[model samples]
Target: MPEIVYAYLDVNYWHPWKIFGSISSVKQLELCLPSSKEYPVGTVFHNLVYLMLCTCETEWLNLLLCLLRDSPKLKFLRFEQYHPIRPSEERPCWSEPSSVPECVVSSLETLEWVKYEGGEEEKEAVAFILRNARCLKKATISAASTDPVKKLEMLKELSFLSRCSGTCHLTFD
Candidate 1:
């Protein structure tokens, strides 16, 4: 798998590292993941530049942070919901990382979130990236809600957050 440069894995398997460990050299990847308690600590994606994740899990922030920490050369990050999520009794959990990721501080340039619900966890994850991505050139957030009132509310809330990149353009889609 060292020769693999791109991979799209939509498997139901929850152990993402087992899949990722085989293809550490991939430059672009798209995958659907369920949250796992343990992160891929030793794996480093030295050549990865673009990543797209399906936000179908309730607790995906940990995995996202872990990937950001490891993908030092990542430039484009995107999140999209591949399937409708049923309401769950538990809300998604999110906790700020102790240190900012190298990708967000230096290499990341573009961000896009589709089917973005204005949930606390979602907002925090998006805000964290926007606040810290110093090289970010654009951020496009497409709200999941169709109602105008809800969209406006989300717009107002997200618009107020300070961005690390002075020239970054933010858009609602």
Candidate 2:
């Protein structure tokens, strides 16, 4: 009946048996995906402005990176986890002749992390995003806990990580 400008995809719910449309109009998306053995291929996002991704594991973040690669028009990215996982997940390791995704190299403008626990994998992901997202304007990282010492540590660590954007602004909360 009307154009859709926003979409939410949560795996914890029932979805239409068959759904398809001119989602070309969608500019924002909120996605909550659970950890699993299988990962979906291909996506419908195009010309998006913002995306908030919630997952239970760091492994799922690769999917987000790939999605962002495809959604070259995306501007802002947000990360949230439904559960705090062990700091065991490894950093992104490409197989061969690896290079940063074009979206990270050019399109991304801002990134924010909510409930960031400063896990190794999380830190690596943040560092990777910062180092590659050449056009990034700002990055905000909020820890799960409000402990002043821990927050300060995380802030120092993330702020110190080199970013490709000369004007990137980093803040912690």
Candidate 3:
């Protein structure tokens, strides 16, 4: 609906796009959903500025990039991991986009990643954002691991990566 501006969806058993796709006017949205086999590319969130996704067992980076490519005005992007990844679940992977998304180059400003584990795919996704988000102003990453050594290694790895935005402040916690 054109009148709808904010929506929070917690989907347990179904693909989220099927429901939210019809509402393109939303400005803020939060979603907690299971991983989907297919990530469609046509849903255009024309007015979306803030988006938060719960990173469950799924192709999260694929979905994030797809949304970023479509939501040209997106400014705030957040990823939250609410549950520990199971050993049996397939590890997620990231494939570089042929072209950077418009939002990352022109609009995205803030990125908050909670429960960052320094996983291969997670590092790739975070690294890609930092390198490409020209307008990014602030990025806060909170490590999920409790081990001091692991956290230090994760921080060291990410801190050396170059950022596109000169003024962007990156904080590791």
Candidate 4:
């Protein structure tokens, strides 16, 4: 089979079949499983490099962390929450885990997030990236708020990009 360069799956149709094996040479995979329970382990995508997950739930996030622990070739990572609508009266939490898989935070060269809600967990994740990902060349964070102060803070924290051999960019709208 040809090396799978990309794979996108909806959450409802996700199944633990040999699809991963069919793409043993895959270099990039993007999953949007809205209801995925667990990611299969030992399913080697030897040539896999880039990974993106969208509209993922908390459990899926856990599975992703586990996958990154094993996938060393991965270089680029992007995550975006897929909430259908902003809460009318309640604000939800957007915290990430205290510890992220070292393989991901340390190896990624580029990281991007859209609609990131600021929280302690999220802060820790960004901190991990800033501290461990020495090779990170660029980072982009987009949020729905247009507040200048909030935007400045994100930029300041991510200003560590200056230390990198490349540049980091942040945007808010």
Candidate 5:
């Protein structure tokens, strides 16, 4: 069998049984969840630098966050969802407020969001990243409702990123 250095799995029948430890050399991984169950967590890609998750469930989001917290070498992350945010009265709480792992912001260079609908949670997510992610060189958000003016407003609200130059591009489709 050819050594699988990198793997990207969508909603397919392929079962994730075993990943080679040699695959620790894997640098990128993408996973899309077709159901609500948690993904296998035992397989560790030590060299993983890029990870993309397109999942609708909160569990998957939590799993991705946990992985990011554990993977010190992770540098890039892209998360997408197909559904609009459902309004809820209560805000979700993190387990550890103070110990919330700070992402390796200096190492991250790019962030991309596709089909995003700006909501309270989504806004909070972006704010958290912008506040902590200091080394991001490029950020792209593509969605139907994300107007250029709104994006500019968001940029203005980011007090931590006062040095960001160049106007962020916005496209409507």
Candidate 6:
């Protein structure tokens, strides 16, 4: 079977699990959903290079972590939960992992998180990624409609966190 370079899955919109079997090498996967329910992660896209995602439900973050934990080759990850017009509203929250995923500590090189609000869970996740991702080269976080004061506070806190990679650059937008 030939390796697949791209795959898009959205249970909320389409059921394409049948086609996934033939894909031996998917390099990019995107998931768009009102995803609060768990998706089976038995199939690991080990060759995946980029992952782009969106989740609209409250339980999305935990489910997300469970799903992506096995992708050791993932280099670029983008999580979209930012609301540009409404910063005061709650964004998706990630639970502190009992053990950090290998991707966060090894293969991942760049992380782009959109609509970050600097919430408690957000801080914990950010801190974990920054401190643990040994191979990480850059992290970009964009928060829309956020208060300047809060943004600065978030920046200061993140800046002080110890990152495993000395070359990693943290950027706020």
- What is the number of backbone collisions in each predicted candidate, taken in the order shown? 0, 0, 0, 3, 0, 1
> Which segments of model 5 are wrong by more than 4 Å?
1-3, 11-25, 34-43, 82-97, 100-103, 146-173
> Which sections of candidate 2 miss by over 4 Å?
1-3, 13-25, 35-40, 82-97
lDDT (Cα atoms) of all candidates against the true structure: 0.88, 0.72, 0.87, 0.60, 0.55, 0.71
Q: How big is the positional error of residue 171 in model 6, measured in Å on the Cα after superposition? A: 0.9
Query: What's the best-to-worst order under lDDT?
Result: 1, 3, 2, 6, 4, 5
Q: 34-82, model 3: which lDDT tens digit per residue?
A: 7555556677898999999878766677668777888999999999987
When 2 and 5 are scored with TM-score, the better candidate is 2
Pairs that collide, model 3: none
- Order of models, best TM-score first: 1, 3, 2, 6, 4, 5
Evaluated against the true structure, the overall lDDT of model 3 is: 0.87
Looking at candidate 4, what is the lDDT of residue 23? Answer: 65
Q: Measured by TM-score, how close is model 6 to the native structure?
A: 0.78
Q: Which is the winner by lDDT between candidate 1 and candidate 5?
A: 1
Tens-digit lDDT track for model 2 on 1-173?
13677887766433321232345457887777544234434544666788888856444666676567657688889988765555676544322216676677878898999998786768888888888888999999889978999988888888889988899999888
Residue 124, candidate 1: alpha-carbon lDDT: 92
Predictions: Cα RMSD each: 1.3, 4.0, 1.4, 4.4, 5.4, 3.5
TM-score of each: 0.94, 0.79, 0.93, 0.69, 0.63, 0.78
- Candidate 6 residues lying further than 4 Å off, grouped into runs, are 10-24, 82-93
Worst 10 residues of 3 by lDDT: 32-41
Error of 5 at 67 (Å): 1.8
Among all candidates shown, the one with the greatest lDDT: 1
- Judged by TM-score, which candidate is best? 1
Native-referenced Cα lDDT, model 5: 0.55
What are the clashing pairs of model 6? 82-115
Clashes of 1: 0
lDDT of 1 by residue, 35-93 (tens): 65656689999999999988887656767887888999999999998977768636677
